[model samples]
Target: EPEVTQTPSHQVTQMGQEVILRCVPISNHLYFYWYRQILGQKVEFLVSFYNNEISEKSEIFDDQFSVERPDGSNFTLKIRSTKLEDSAMYFCASGDTSGTSTDTQYFGPGTRLTVL
Candidate 1:
């Protein structure tokens, strides 16, 4: 079965630097989302994209963040300026939200971003 894949399972960066987390979402899926968990916190939604435009976004998606579908299969999240509080496990998910009750999101293993 197709699954979401993320690169550099773990990353450590200093504050003020930039980082780009990569993800390969499941093929044939339409709805893509980004979520993060800060250690013991709950999974917070960042953004959701479809048809090459943002469908919904949370307050967590601030000016420092951006997302792109650079190709047919690759999706990426870029943080222009990192902060210590930005440390978290970033997860990429994809699902088919075409009114199908069986459509559930499949998440990647996650990319742990550590900012110091």
Candidate 2:
């Protein structure tokens, strides 16, 4: 019955500002990931983290974006410099710790980021 928790339900930032969104996923999950959906656009994968390091990343996860698990219980996504195009709903997700890729990913409600 556990689920992901994201802080600052919504964020408003000016272009070029830095933003960090936080999340706390299901306790027993081992893999974490970040995804985003631009308003009216398709959802896109940003990055995947496991064992405290990045396991995989998509082209959208460029130098401008980064993720970390500063504390075992919290997962965070940081956008070094916000862009208008970066405005989107960012979701946090986690998968089972079964050590198999087949496990399903459970997603958080998401943090809506708005950029001017």
Error of 1 at 116 (Å): 1.0
In angstroms, how far off is 92's CA in candidate 1? 0.3
The clash numbers for all candidates, in the given order, read 0, 0
Candidate 1 per-residue lDDT over residues 1-116, each given as its tens digit:
78899998999999999999999998888888899999998999999888888888999899999999999998999999999999999999998758255768899999999999
Query: Candidate 2 deviates by what RMSD?
Result: 0.8
Question: Which stretches of model 1 miss by more than 4 angstroms?
Answer: 97-103
The numbered model that scores best in lDDT is 2
Relative to the unseen true structure, what is the C-alpha lDDT of residue 10 in candidate 2, on a scale of 0 to 100?
97
- Estimated TM-score per prediction? 0.94, 0.97
| lDDT of each residue in 4-113, candidate 2, tens digit only | 99988999999999999999989988899999998888889999999989999999999999999998799999999999999999999999997587979999999999
Worst 10 residues of 1 by lDDT: 96-105
Superposed by TM-score, candidate 1 places the C-alpha of residue 6 at a distance from the truth, in angstroms, of: 0.4
